[model samples]
Target: MKTALTELVGIRHPVVQTGMGWVAGPRLVSATAEAGGLGILASATMTYDELAAAIKEVKSRTSEPFGVNLRADAEDAARRVELLITEEVRVASFALAPKKDMIARLKDNNVLVVPSVGAARHAEKVAGWGADAVIVQGGEGGGHTGGVATTLLLPSVLDAVDIPVVAAGGFFDGRGLAAALAYGAAGVAMGTRFLLTRESTVPDEIKQAYLARDLNGTVVTRKVDGMPHRVLRTELVDALESAGPVSGLARAARNAAKFRKLTGLSWRSLATEGLRMKRGGDRTWSQVLMAANTPMLLRAGLVEGDRSAGVLASGQVVGLLDDLPAVGDLIETIVADATGILRRLASE
Candidate 1:
């Protein structure tokens, strides 16, 4: 139960409910926080004002420490960091590697910084730059992911970084928690498992679709965002795969415009964010435009509950998840089981 992550975030258990976009809202976050796990509110899809309001709402619901997941390449990254500092959020998590200065500023304000990395080098980079901890998500994780399996990637990151590393990707239960601890991780971070909980705000229909899936239900495709993205194989995803490059670019353009309007972002602002993303990872201009497709497509399914038109970002763990439990019960059960497993192993 108590690990470096628990000590770092002051949570009773080492379990973490990842900040899944559109799913990790105030209700689920507060529920997880109250359940004694570190619940991170996803802020990439939220406007600056919306993020502040959601943070306040979570604070109103639970006094326990929580974190905000941020897009390190967002145009308003500085302002967001300032907001977190001003509001005194306990932690800040980054989707991509954060700049040294951003990490420095948050640490200066006593906010713990945890960047999710896919490789040992990235983990080492952030660890050297004073990140409080790292969440290493492997290929089995939903959304943007890498090719390495957690079994291999976890140890590589552990060997490279002295800071706490939370294992993610394909983790859903207490047995996985014990396995991660045995792998020398500080804890585990789960996105899909938390998203399927009763406390999650995802539409029931969407949850049902997720629950119906099996181990082979998800697909990893670069068609979604020009980067490897793991999503449940749906009709929309199939169509995307079948589309030609020219057609894909056309769709990306339209969605870029839609996302700009939906988020009230100016063309200049979108361009700045796009350029930042491109520079960070050597992405092409076309890839930058395709990147806009992620939020809108995810919103159609996750927020509007449209299965026919939207795509579901899901981990391979969806196969193992069959029931929806309340956040409190889920956390309690996981903690109890993991403790027993650890005890049994130690005695053996």
Candidate 2:
């Protein structure tokens, strides 16, 4: 049904397909947009040029409004922000809290700024900086997540921020949408749920693997890099978790090099970014490197189809999902089910 999120983003449905690197690409984004959901392209894994091309491709595929998730701290973040302005994207989403200047720049260009936050403080900070909205993802969310659960964090953020809040984490169905709405959220933002959909770039074999797991199949561990990351409990994940910080440091060092090569970052620039992360309380150099490797690890599973060697960031909702349906079908089912659930609750 129509909610503030739907009207703000100019989409028919209040649901959102969150940006998952290597998973939420042109195909998935366009499909979700066509399906009446606000799909966001994950720009963390793409170069500035690649992101621009993908945005154009999505525009060609559908005229519906969509968003782009950017690395607010990237070296070329300004360039990427410029691309969004030039493309006239409906919304500009940030993986973390964006700089006040960046937020102002986008708002000046008529782009809606929505940053994903894990805590109430972050929501307040972004709202104070003039963000159009905020997406609050709790501890149960996939990828890099905080320790607060959605049940607690959602209302905390809603109470703290005046802007619209989209509840995320541990949400995979109509029941979740209803729960989020009841919590005073404008809508729900889904990551793992959308990544497991038929339109996602995730391999069929891996998608099947995700479908087979129950709620207990997923685990959150700091072993992946240095930060606590939520991922499937594969054999590799187990090995890494047990390896401890030393091993993680070693891996992070190597991955940092690879990331530099892939993203064309100079050593000076990489070290500067690493230092920024470290100063911001990430602590160790390993944690700094892992921050960048997080996207690459997810790409291994999502784009390359290697579950064993890759880190698959997924929400606990994976256990609740069984089938991979087309984006259109999935959105329709969710909207209809949510409507029915709301009506039933009203009657009660």
> Which one is best on lDDT?
1
Model 2: how far residue 197 lies from native, Å? 1.2
Model 1 lDDT at residue 117:
92
What's model 2's overall lDDT?
Answer: 0.88
TM-score of candidate 2 to 2 decimals: 0.97
Model 2, span 1-348: residue lDDT tens: 899889888899999999888888999999999999999999888877789889999999999999999989888999988999999999999987999999999999999999999888888888999999999998999888989999999999999988889999998888889889989999999998898888887899989989999999889988766677888999888898777677777777777777778877678888898898788884677777776667667777878898877888889888899988888998888888888999998999
Candidate 1 per-residue C-alpha lDDT over 1-348 given as tens digits, one digit per residue, 9 for 90 to 100: 789999989999999999888899999999999999999999988988999999999999999999999988787889999999998999999988899999999999999999999999999899999999999998999999999999999999999999999999999888999999999999999999999999899999999999999999999999978899999999889999998889889988998999888776788988887887788797888888898899888999999999998879999999999999999999999889999999998999
lDDT of 1 at 338: 91
What root-mean-square deviation over C-alphas does model 2 reach? 1.3
Clashes of 2: 0
Runs in model 1 with CA error above 4 Å? 279-282
**What's model 1's TM-score?**
0.98
Evaluate all candidate structures by whole-model CA lDDT and list the values in order. 0.93, 0.88
